[model samples]
Every structure is written in C-alpha cells, then in structure tokens.
Target: MSREPNQRLAALMAEAGASNKGLAKRVRETGLRHGRRVGTTHVTVQRWLNGGGIQPETASLVAEALSSKLQRRITPTDLGFPTAASSPVAVAPSYATSLPDTLDVLDRLAQQSLDDEQSSGVLLPESEVNSAVLSWLISHPDTLRVDVPAQRRVGMRDVAAIRTAGQMFMRLDFLYGGGHGHKALRHYFRQEVLPLLSASYSAKVGNALFGAATEISQLLGWTAYDTGNHALANRYLLSTLRLTKAIDDRMMGARILSNMSHQANYLGQISRATQLARAATEGGKGRATPRAMAMYAAHEARALSSAQDHTSAARAMNEAEKHLERADSAEDPDWLSYVDEAELVGEFCHCFRDLGRGPESLRYAERAVALTDPQYARTLGFCRMVLAQSQLLNGELEAAVTTAGLAVEGGDALQSARFQRYVSDFQRDVSSHAGVPAVQAFNTKVRDALADLDDE
Candidate 1:
C-alpha cells in the first residue's frame, strides 16, 4: 500500500557512516521518545532496508528519528507513508490551549504513576483514546504502521497520545538507561518534537510538550553522564535549559537544571554547578516545595563542596533543611518526591566528606542509613556507601567494610554500570587496607562479583 519507507534512511546512513547495527541503535533511541523499546539487533533495522512495511502510525517517529541523526529534515512519506493528516487538505486543527491544563494533565499522570509503572487513564477522559496511545508507547519502536495507515482526529486524543509517548520516553530511558539506545532519541528530539514545539505550542500543548521534552532530555543527559559522555550531557542540558522559558513547567525545568548541577559537580565544574543550582533556586523562588527547595539546596551544596566552600555549603545545607520542611506545604512536582529527607542527608554526607569533616559526614550518613525504607532502596544503598567511604578514610576500616557490604548488596538489585562503578570504587577503597581482615573479605566479595559479571 505504501511506497518504500523512504530514501532518506539509506541516504542518511551514508552520511553518518552508520552500519546496520548503528542505524538500529539510532532507531531504538528515537522510538524511546515515543515510549517504545526498539533494540540494535539485526531484525528491526533490517526490516526497514528490506521494505518490510512499518505501521503507518509510527511514521512520525521514524521521520523524527532519521531527521535528528542525519542533521536534516525527514518526512513521513519519505518513510513510505501518507502524511499524518489524510489527503493533506483536511488537516487537524491547531491546538493552542492554556498552559495550566497541560500541566494539570502532567500532574494527573504522575499521580497515576504511583499506582502503575506503565501508567495511563489519568490524562485523557476517553478510554479508547488513552488505550491506543498506551499501546503505542510500550510497543517496540519499529513495530508500527508503515502499511496500516490510520488517520488520527486531533483534539484531546492527540494531546494524550503525545504526552503518553513523552512520559514513556522519560521513564524507560531512566530505567534501562539512555546509552542502550540514544542516537534515535537525539534525532527525534532534534526533528519531530522540536519542529512541533516550534510551530505553535498552545499554552496548553506547548507546556505539555515542553515538560515532556525536559524530562526526556534529562534522561538523555543521565545516559550521557553514566556513559562518561560529559560533553554530550552538558550540551543536552544547555539545550533543555533554553526551553525553560517557553515551557512554563517551572518544576520540571528546575529539577532538570538541578540535575545539571549534579553532573557539573561530578565533572568538577564547580562554578557551573553553582550557577545552575543558584539559577534553579532562583527559578523556583516563590513556589518552594520541600522537594524543590531541597533539590536546589542540594545542588548549591554540591557546587560549594566542589569549590571547597565549607561555610557556604553548610549554610546551603541548612537552607535545604528549611526548604524541605515546606515540601508538604507546596504542591508536589512530578519527579521530586524522590528527593526526600534521606536524600537530603545523603547529599549532605557527601558534601561533608568532600570537605573532610568526617564526624559530621558520619552523623549524617548514619541518619541516612536509618531512613532507608524498602521502597527507597536505591537512595539507601547510596547513603550506606557514603558512610562506608567516610568511615574508611576516618580510620574506621571495620565499620566501613561492614557498611560497604550493605551498599554492595543494595547495588546488586540496580544492575547499573554507574552503580557498579560506585560499588567498585568502594571496593577499591576497601582493598587498599588489605591487611584488615574485614577489608580483605570485602575486597574478595567485590572481586568475585566483578568476575561473575565478566563471566556472564
């Protein structure tokens, strides 16, 4: 029914010097922006070259994906389909709704997420409409309509679909990781989403898209961070920060910027960290939820720690504490409840450790360890690791070794290379004290774990 998917894919392949597998990886990344999980295996990218028609509905995704990576525009018809609109004459109406409604939808979706991982039924009123979008997001990135063309009626339905795709992109990128399939995402953001955002985001649709993109971009940055692609992560963060104005989703932008501060601190860009954190603090000046204020303060403290500004860091930590007390008073931001007291304490412990204030670090670390609820397993693991590291340096090798084991156990459930890197760092620290029996045992456990992973 459709012509060949597009000449652009083949042409673009030539430009990027991408092999079949590379292209496959890119496709998976782009598909993720729409909440699909495509991989870099042979079958998926191969299907496209063979003219194995894709579902028509996913053409936008394909178009977005190709356009972004090649640094050029791509079309749906270029991918072997009719355009998103039928006949090109009967087009969907431009949706320019209020910003508040868009955010309300986002808020509602996040609330529903607590109950369901693959969340839905919160954004749209029509069950059928929400369900269709849901199916699109979770499906394989390449498994969509190149042949079975379907015309979508634009309205609440289209908005819901877009939001759903955006959310899926954010969540999956965080869970499995952004590096797993990122080229595709980079392309989609550059092409499909950018143009749409540029054309006319209603206060309504614009805010939603802005918020969604901000979240997704942060996830992309996280992937960059994890994979040690600092330049790429910084560039993405800069780009997303530019979108903060038009987006009107203050909380999302602030949190993302705070994340940038985190990355900057990690990369030892202390001035940049200070700027970003301070800016985020300024951005959310009036509406300070405990989470938001704490996030901002955490950023500031991290920056100060990196600068070795202990006085300022301590002050910022105090400010963070004050702000956290207000988190319950303000409305919850989508991603920030994860930044609770335990997280604050963990951040504080890290700051103190960096400043070489061992006793204070230990105090906060113990408090952090005490706060580890089962649901917050990841945060708890990190805190314990911090305690161990500080203890090791403070001449408490036995206690450090003990806490380090708990940290490693906590990390076992995470399956992250970055997490593993932290665990490995602690292991390395423990091994330096090989004469200590507990340290030797800890070293043995980590060495064995590394070997096990290698054998796999």
Candidate 2:
C-alpha cells in the first residue's frame, strides 16, 4: 500500500527556504556529531519531500539538523513522520557489564534532555518501563573498574559535594515545589556532574560517584514530575534505576521504582503503577527500611484504590500502616526520612478519596493537614483542597467553600502543577453550585489567585 504525501514537511521546507541539497548536507553533518554515518543525499531529501518516507534514524537526524538551522525545536512528528514506526536508539542497557558503556548512556541522555527539540513531545513507552523493571529484577551486579585516564582525579570530596547538592535541591523542592528549582538542577547536572562521570577515579570513588548520580537523577525525575513533565521524569527515573541496580543498591532501586509508580498513577496508568509498585517491594526484599516498605505499600494502595479494587486497596492500606508502625526514623536512610506517619496518612487520604469514601478521606485529610510541617506550603494547600473535596462529597457545601477559599489563599506559594491540578479539580467540583453566593465567590478567588500565580 502506498502512503499519502507529507504536505507538512513540504510546507516546513518552504518556510525554512531550504534547498533539498542544503538540507541533506546539514543532516549528514549533524549525524556525524551523533556518530551516525547517515548516507542521505539530495535525492533522498527529495524523496522525503515528495511523500516518501526515510528510515527513523534519518528522520531524527533531519529533525535535529532542521531545528538547528531554523533556530527552534523540530520534531519528527512535525515533519509528518510516524513516530510510532521509529525504533528508538538503544543505549547500552543498564545491566551492561561495561562501566564505560553505562557512562556513555548517561552522557547521551543528559545531552538529549538538554536539547529542547528532542525533549519536547517525547514519551517514555509503557513497554520501556516494564523492560527496565524486568532487567533491574534479573540482572546481576557488574564488577566495576574506573581506571580510565581523564582531565581530573575525582575524589571522595567530589562525591560528597554531589550528595550535598542533592540534599539542598531536595529541600528546595519540598519547600517551594519542583518547579522552583528544576531548571537550576538540570543546569548543575550538565555543567558539574557530566564532567565528573568522565574523570579518572579508583573503584571506591567510582562507586560513590555513581551512587550520588543515581540519587541526583531520582530527584531530577521527581522535580520533572512535579512540573507535569512525565515523559522526562520517566526517562530520568529509569536511568536512576539502572544505576542503582548496577551498584547493587537494592534500597535505592526500590525508592526509584516507588517514585516511578507515583508518576505512572498520576498519568492514569493504573496498571503500570501497580506493576512498578510491586516491583519496588520485590526489589527491596530484605534490604529496604520499614519506612521504605511502608511507602511502597502506600503507593500500591493508592493505585489499587484508583483501579477501584477496594478489597485489595484496604489490605494494602493496612499493610502500609503496620510497616509504618515498625518504622524507626533514626535507622532509616536519609532519603527515606521524608516518609513519616503524616505522609502515610496523606496517602491514605488520597486513596480513600479515590475510592469515594468521603468520610474516611475527610478524617485522614484533616489529620494530614495538622501533621504536615508549616514549611511544606504546597503540601498544606493540597491537603486543604482534598479536605474541601471531601466536604463537598459529604454535602457540607458551605464548609467546602470555606476550605477551598483557604486553598486559594495558599495557592500563590506553590509552584507545582500538581497543586494547580488539585485547584482545577476543586473548581470543577463547585461548578454545579455556582448559583450559590459562597461558591461563586470561591470560584472568583481561585481564578484570581491562579492568574496571579501565572503572572509571577
């Protein structure tokens, strides 16, 4: 069967005022930078412009070349290419035995993420997530050596600096939300971390460096998710998981998987969310802290509730509570310190809300709001929104309106898209009651606050 002509590509070419030969030449040069020896010529470019297709790899190179020439991002889809047919370029699998191969993959990923054109509209497929999880489960740790010569000798101090920077960014994210510091993190990763990965080091220093990288990558994924960039979040998370498995860090791997499950659930991928959460538990096995296990179970419970499996959800919720009861904060990893009882209660509130149990949701929501720290402004706002929804569900319309107004008052403090989503959901919930004076006033306040936030 013959395919239709790609009129979009022709139009783009006309807009760019690019001759076929000039475009082909530029693509070949761009391919060389990516280590791809593309054989595209004027004739091939003409064929593409005339509705004929090119190889997926060639299409990607063409998009990159055009993006550079046009001074903006260009994607294969923009050129009327079927992205589904293109096989993504495979990096060395996270389970690969070669340390250099793993570093190379990380370098490429960082570069791709920095490229605005390539990063935009790219989705991490469900199959990739499943495959990564499977590999993490089955792969054995490689005997790593870091003997390669480099511009500088990396040391323990460098590793500590990375960890310290990660902690700082984590605190910033928690206080102000991911959107507050994600770009700066990305910049630091590209400028500082990427070079360190290539520096010469002993086996001990190399292990520590990779460990810090893994942690930083996980944080990066979390911030991306907070900003509603799920595809980028998934990529960073999968990268982190591979690094953790490579180092035989089961606890960290479990944490990464738990985060992945959260992002999956948020995107309405309930099945994948459940699978990832189960994998987190399995990966942790005997290695994870009680607190970590509780976090994993809490995520599973939320997914189950979202899937409307009330029986399983309740069971998972109980399991989470039991584990949390046994959790000792002093004995847990610093990363897992944030998963306290209050956080678990908040998760329970979310699960019950999803299950349409309004009273349970309200009870937990109130407790979570009281337990949450004042520094966590975004979380407080979110909890308030949850409380408002529960009130509305229970037919306490006036109380709901008042709680929602408080949510709006705090909205300006958060930079999270997730928080904005909660605000939007609250708006929708009260839309039917717009005839009520309180509802109308609440709606007006929320709209004005959102507009102010946008302006800032």
Candidate 3:
C-alpha cells in the first residue's frame, strides 16, 4: 500500500518537522501550484495515512515533497500503488482526429438517455464518403442535429453528451475557477476528446465538431491561465483563436484574444499585448456592443498602461469610457450578456489598479468588489488585494493590513496562482513596512503559509 518504503515517510516528516496537518496542507498547496485537484482534507489525509489510497496527483505531490526534503528521486510508487489504477483522472492522455470524424463521433448518441444523446439529424450514407456531405452539414445551421446518424463507436458520443461535458466544465469553472477546472478538462482533452479532433470529417460536421473543440480549448486555455501555466496557456489561447476563426465565432475569438493581451502584459510582452488587444477589438467588428467595446478598449488601456504610455492610456481610457456609455444605450449580444454598468467600473478599476494609480484604482476596486458575484472568490480575492495595495500605498496601514488579511482568507479557500502572485506582490510591498504591527502580522501569516507549502 505504499509507493516508496514506508520507513521514509516518517523519517522525512520528522526531519522536516511537519505535522500530518502541516504536511497535508503543504502537499495540497504545492499540488495546486503544479496543477492538481485536492478537495477533501482531514478525512482524505486520514484515509491515506490509514493506507486508504492516494491519486497520481497526490503521488506527484508526495514525490515532490520527498525529493526536496530527502534530496533524492521519489515517485508515486514510493507512496503506494493500491492495485494500480488506470490513471489519474486529471491527466488523462489525448486523442486527436480531423474535423468531420470528430464531429460525427460527438453528434452520434443513443435514444432516451439522461444525456439526451443525439447525432446530426441528417444521415450520412456510410456507402458514400464525399465532400458533398461536409458542405451540407456546414450550410445547415439548424440545431436540429443532435446525434450523428447511425454511426456506432464507444468513443463516439451524441452532441448532447458533448454539450453536457461543456456544461460540466462550465459549472466547475464557475464553482472553482479555471485553476481547478483546467486539469479536469485537460483530462478530457487527453483521453476521449482530442483524438477525435485528429481525424478528418466533412467541412459541415468538422465545423460543428470544431465548435465543440473550440469551447473545450477555451476552457483549457482558461484553466491553464488560472493555474499559472503562461506558455501553455498562450498555446491553448491561440489554438482556441484559430478554432473560433474556423467556426467563425468572432465574438468568442475576440474575447480569447483580449485575454491573451492580459497574459502578454503579465509576462512583460507589452507591445505584443497591445497588438493583440488591438486585434481583438478589430476582430469584434460590428459585434462589439458599447459594453464589449469598452471592455476591449480597457484591455488595450491596460496594456498601454503597463508599457507606461500615458498618452495612449489616456486616449484608450477615453474611448473605453465612451464605449461604456454606448453600452448603456445599446442591446448587448448573448456573449456579452453578463457585462453591465458595474462591470465597466470594475474593469477600468482593475486596469487602474495594475497601473498603480492608487486612489483612482481604489475607487474602481471597491466598486468592482461590490458588483462582482460572491461565487467568484478568486476575482474577489484579487480585488481585495488590489484594494489593500492601494490603501497601503496611501498610508492607511491598519486598513491595508486588515484588507490583506481578508484577501488571505479568500485566497486560502481557493486554488489560484495569479492570486498567489498577487499575495506575493503584496507581501513584497509590506516587507518595506516591517515596523508596522499590521505588516508584521501579515508577514507572519504569509511566512506560515509559505512554510506550510514548503513542508509539502
């Protein structure tokens, strides 16, 4: 029931001075940093210690902790195999095929299932495999096609099933943010999903299948971004962009590019970020509502501000505000259904916070937090951190520290690398205020968390 010799676990724990809680907390935190799902705590740890079981994610975590502590190679086998599972559900391998076949597989499903599986309403005569079928599938824009007609394969699923998968991912993303959602979706991409994308399907079916892939890729991109895999995140983002173009979802495409801009700026690729933001705005074409336009402009403003171009920033800011005004007067597209008046302030405030415009940023930060959904714990956590930074810079030490503490509480409950970076940044700033009691308290807490992470 153990991977490495059981003797080592106790020895390493004693050498590192980590209690079971401390070790588990550290493992969970580090697991998150490396991209893993680690829900359940005391009970899970109890089971593992009581020779229950641990997943590959847990194995990797234990391996990481042991290697660091013992200065030697270690792996999941060192922990325990427990009858050898097929794989960790989070890191399943991938399968890819061309457009039509993938679509055909997704659109094919059984009748009267809870999954409501259905294939393309039109039957593709298996006897004739030609381009005509492909063209017809694409030209027919109706949602009537539920399952691909009459094809049977274990890997093949109905459109409804694909949609159900999408919904599942969307729900997880909503509940846990992309950080946790990415790995789950990635497993799908690696296993039953991506292989289909590798095959060649007719253009019509291909596009439909591509549409599903695009959403999955978008989620993958989002998860990677949220988990701090910048390079992989950008790769998935670009893939999503290309897929959206093939499927002609300019709105979604533009949104992905806008997000890319943020990532570029984060990585200090200022010009690239600016260019991408501009391209995103342009890509939106007439689809950009006042709100969408404003949001897009704000993304550009954020990039420009990062590059320290005040003139461009001002111009972009003005245009963004104008766009926001227009949004107030216009009917938004379905994709932009979530954006509203408060979101505008929140977006601009976020850009300002990043630009280090303390007072103005604080105003926007407060408004955004007030307007943001409580379920969006990560966003709220980042907002609180922004507010803390502003307050700290403005000499409101007590308020800053208290706000930072709240951010910590919010952060602890979620798994996000960006939030961690935000905390790290806050910690760096507070280090300069070491003499203050609030700063001291905050630093102590951060160190404790960091230490716990080290133990894992």
Candidate 4:
C-alpha cells in the first residue's frame, strides 16, 4: 500500500529554512551526541518527503533536529507520523506541579500500560530522565490539602493497608521478578489506591497517604524496569518524585532519584545516570538514613565505573562502605530495610566487574552470593552472573562456565527480562572461549533455559 507524503514535515522544513542535507546532518550530529549512530541521508530525507514512513526512532531524531532548528517543540504527530507511545525514543511526560495533577497522570499511565502490552519494551528518553531528575532536585513541597469531600473516608488505616499491599507486591517482585504479579499490582493501584487520593482525609492522614502512594509508585517503576518496560517505568518514577515533592519527603525524593539513576545506567545513559545519582546524594544529604545514603553512593560508584573513571568509582565505593558501616537497620524505613551488607557488596561486584578489576570483583561477587538469601531469587541470579563474568575476566574459563550454568539454573525460576538479558550478556562474554567443552555445555544449558521460558 502507498502512504501519504509527509507534507507537514516539508512545511516545517520550509518554515525553518532547512535543506534536506542540512537536516540530515543535524540528525546525525544529534544522534552522535546521544551515542547513537544515525545514518539518515539526504536521500532518506527525500523518501520521507515522498510520504515514506519513518521508523519511530528516526522520527524522534527528525523531530528533535527540527525542534532545535526552529526553536520550538515538534512532535512525531507534527511531522505526520502516527504517535508511537511505545517508542523507545518518545518524549516523556513532563513533571506535574500539583498533587491532583500528578495523580491524574499516574492513573492515566497505569491505564495506558494496562491496555498496551508493548509498554514493556519502551525505553525512557535521555532528555526526560535528566529533566525529571533536575526537577525533583529543585522542587519544593506543594500544598497538601487533600481533604476532598468524597463518599468514602480515607484514614490512617487505609494508608496502612496500601502500604501493606505494596510491601507484599514488592516481596513478590524481588523473589519471582516483575512479571510475576505486575498486572495484579497495577490493578490494585488503579482500583484500590487512586480512589483514596480523592477521598476525604485529615491533613496528617493525607501526608501519610501521599507517602504511601509514593512507595507504591516507586515499586511500580522498579517492577516495570525489571520487566523491561523502561518508558513506563520512567513515568511511574516521575510520578513517585512528584508525590514525594507534595509530601516534602527529601529522603523519598532522593530514593526516587536513585531509582531513576539505576534505570539510566541500565539503558546506557551513563552521564545521565551519574548526574541523577549525584543528585540523590545531594538531596538525601541530611535527611536520608545511613543505609539509604549508602545505596545512593553505591549507585554513583556503579555509574562512574561504567564511565571508566576507576579512581572516582573506587572512592565512591569506599564512601558507600563507610555509610553502610554506620547503618542501623532499626532506624531504617521499611522500604529501605533491604539494603544491607549483601546489597552493598553486590554493587561493589558490579562496579569492579565493569571496571575490569577481575580479582576484586570475583571476591565481592562470591561474598555477595554467599550473603544473599535463597528467597531473593532474582538478586541471586544477577549475583551469580557477575561471578561468572568475573571468573571469565580472570582467565578461569572452566570455573566461569560452571558458575554460568548455575546462574542459568537459578534463572529458570525467574520471570524477569533483566535476568534474561544477564544470561544473554554472559553467553556473549563466554563466546570468546567457545572451543572449551565447559563453555559449550554452558551454552547448551542457556539455550534450553531460554526455550523453557519462552514456552511458559
């Protein structure tokens, strides 16, 4: 079938006084800045002008390039492209300034995510990540008057129930991965939690209610991340930050920033990841508990290592350890109770693994594995992958394969896309030693494991 010409794009280009070659050049330069290799040429521009469809990713690049040249926002729709809500490069939802507005956005996001299964594969744009982090860093508390007259009254008990349910879902996420109960969690939030936002409640109860909502938002973001719905994860995280701002909870704000940083790092936005992590540390400074601070610092170290800044990474790791040493679990919020010695060490293992510090990473990976409980299946699978990679970097090919096989076995029980990515990464790493019998056997095991997962 023939497609209509992108007349809107042509008009925009004419208005901006941009030539096909110039616009293509700008798109390539923009992609390079974002660490993407865009190969759009003037011929491709002509094809688009002739009503040829552009890929969602390239449409974003074109929109961005034109927006910069024209000094205005130009969306994909403006270029006559159908809106790609699930596109990895789609613009993110802007930060909301009011509590009701934030709740509206959250409700919409949940509904959209539930309706569209493709939301699971969307990537959060780098610009949106930076914008949300910066906004949270500078934002102040909005008025907390949530006592709207509703048929149902929201009390502390209602808030407590929300918290309890959120905690239960969180535990399930940690153990079986995000795919386990993600749909149920979203349903609970939409049906059970959002209604309370508009219900009548006292000032004290309102603040606590928003706080509880923030925790649930954060968990939703995390599980989305685990299940590979990165764009949806970012939306939830942005909402979480907005809720924190309404409650004036600096510690929660910092925690949300850290979560955003983790997603950034996972998506290869190293600079954005580092910036968000630094913001977390700064925002959490006098307000966060010792364990929380340690978690922030560990994430910073991980980003630094990815950037190949060995010295700064080590320094950040040491800072994290020092904070961990001072942490008292009794003072920690229930949400942060999980960050202990094992978690910090797991961060250490990742940092060293990224920096190619084989021996140190191997030791930390081993310790992390030993310290992690059996119930935390997802975390254990990740730790094992790190150990296997560490062994490979140390030239212990046989040991690496053996460890990798164990990791695959553990992964059999996980419903996480992140865990599968880890398995793929490990498989790629060991491919260099394909001649080895152990490596070959491990490859077979991974293939079988993935097949079983797909069948399920």
Instruction: Identify the candidate with maximal lDDT.
Output: 4
Please list the C-alpha lDDT of all candidates, in the order they appear.
0.59, 0.78, 0.61, 0.82
Candidate 1 residue spans exceeding 4 A from truth: 1-202, 287-290, 411-414, 454-456
Please tell me which model should have the higher lDDT, number 1 or number 4.
4
> TM-scores, in order shown?
0.61, 0.78, 0.61, 0.78
lDDT of 2 by residue, 58-125 (tens): 77677667756553335577798876223564332232223443444454455444324544555567
* Clash totals, every prediction: 18, 0, 38, 2
Against the true structure, what is every candidate's RMSD? 14.6, 10.9, 18.5, 11.3
Q: Write the per-residue lDDT of candidate 4 for residues 141-199, one digit (tens) a residue.
A: 77655555457788899999999998999899888888788888888997798777766
Candidate 1: residue 191 Cα off by (Å): 9.8
Which lDDT value does model 2 have at 234? Answer: 71
lDDT string, candidate 3, 1-456, tens digits: 453434445545666676677777767765665466576365565566556656655665665555454333234454554433234323211110222222222221101111111211222222221222223223322221223332332232544456579768765765556666564566676455554544434556655565666677676766666766654565456545544544566667678878888887877778778977887788776865678878788889989888878788879888888887777687754435556666566667767766778889888878877887766566677778887887876778788889988877664434667777888888888777789887888888877765665464
Candidate 3: global Cα-lDDT? Answer: 0.61
Cα lDDT tens digits for candidate 1, 1-456: 754654555665666677778766766775664467754455665676666655543554555556565433355555555544132211111111222212212222222211233331221122332232233223332111111111321234445655566556555544444444455555555444443432333345544555565655566556565555554455444444444444344566567667777876776667767877876787667645667878788879988988999899989999999888877877874656467887888889989988988888899889988986655554566678889888877889888889888776553423455656667788776666678788778777776766775575
Candidate achieving higher lDDT, 3 or 4:
4
Candidate 3 has a TM-score of: 0.61
Query: How do these models rank on lDDT, best leading?
Result: 4, 2, 3, 1
